[model samples]
Target: MNDIAPQVARRVLLLDGAMGTMIQSHHLDEEAYRWQGITAEGSSEILNLTRPEVIAQIHRSYLEAGADIIETNTFCANRINLLEYGLEDHVDIINRRACRIAREEARDRAYVAGVMGPTNHALSLASKLEDPAFRRFDFNDFHASYLEQALLLIEGGVDLFLIETVFDTLVAKSAIIAALDAMERLSVHVPIMVSVTFSDASRRTLSGQSLASFIETMAPFPLFSLGLNCSTGPEEMIDLIQEMSETSPF
Candidate 1:
């Protein structure tokens, strides 16, 4: 994987649209995701190992569509999220395989951004508003899980890391740190792009942090870019994104 900073600095880069949505269009059944006689239906990450061709096809389509970047199908591939389906132990293989599939299809046509999604749990949010401090997982847990995922993603040859669709600033912070830590340990470096989601026009993270706070919280890191992703349509997000550009130093 090479540093994309120069190219990113030159012009606006186009990233492919939703991977899960495109996968759903195929309407694959439980058998498509089955591996080792165990069926983990709806887990797209497993498709990299069991059905690499399918993942490859999706990458090809996006590249053919003029996307400068195609994300590896590894979102929610982390141990914490995979535990719900009992596929936690297969995290490394799944992530590595996903990158291989994406890299093969990309083949110098586009950069492969390793997609690390926010896990199902949050470090701050709880079921009730009153229990603001109550969390099922802690910061260290998030960091460790992200570290394991980041290490293999780097080993698998991702051009950059996309810690995207973050709902919790705390979670994004953990991922950012883990990615940097992974690079230090492996003696390899790649740019990281962070994209957060605003719950609404309120312009606040789901965990209740204001956009300014989110920018302030992430300011210390040498991020490749900071922007918005899910949670609203373009018309609704334009102002927020413009505000981000004005407020963010990235």
Candidate 2:
């Protein structure tokens, strides 16, 4: 999988469009998939739980749409997110199923990007300081959770790790470190890509760091690629990508 990336580098890679938008198109009434456990019976987000075949069909649709990279339908597969709806136990099952569905559909033509989103726990200074139990916000806890998810994704045969919609730099850093640790433990060397979400008012991440700072912080890591995702829209993202490209060292 790592070798395939270089061969495809000559051409621009096309990632599938928004997953939320696609999910919403199906008319599910759930607030979000994080808590609803798309696989849970009778849950509005049951497409992930009950209608995974439908989800895999969606991946096939994207592939037919000319996407070079197809992300798994497991953005909220981590324990932190699943814990919201008491579905934490299904974390491994959900992530594994997502990768399996994607791999089955993608076969050998497209790349399977294991999708991960931000933690459900807020990372704002105010939130942390207010919670007495917050202590120091242990990176180890974050690392263990992400490592669990990454190992499942890798075991399911994902081609790469796609950490997207990150707002907190600390959490994002922890996730990257967790991914690295997981690779070392599993003895697998797959590429990773990290992206952040931004607010409309400010171009910076939720933590107030500019994209340049985020890129610089992650520069030491062996990232196959990096960019922004799930903020504003394509028009705004295009501007951000252009700005990032001009300033980015890579």
lDDT of 2 by residue, 52-87 (tens): 767887888899999988998877777776666567
* Segments of candidate 2 deviating more than 4 angstroms: 29-46, 128-137
lDDT of 1 at 177: 98
> How well does candidate 2 match the true structure in TM-score terms?
0.87
TM-score, cand. 1 vs. native: 0.95
Query: Residue 192 error for model 1, in Å?
Result: 0.7
Which window of 10 residues has the lowest lDDT sum in candidate 1? 124-133
Give the alpha-carbon lDDT of every model: 0.89, 0.76
Q: How well is each residue in 150-174 modelled by candidate 1, as lDDT tens digits?
A: 9999999999999999998888889
Clashing pairs in 1: none
lDDT minimum window of 10 residues, candidate 2:
37-46
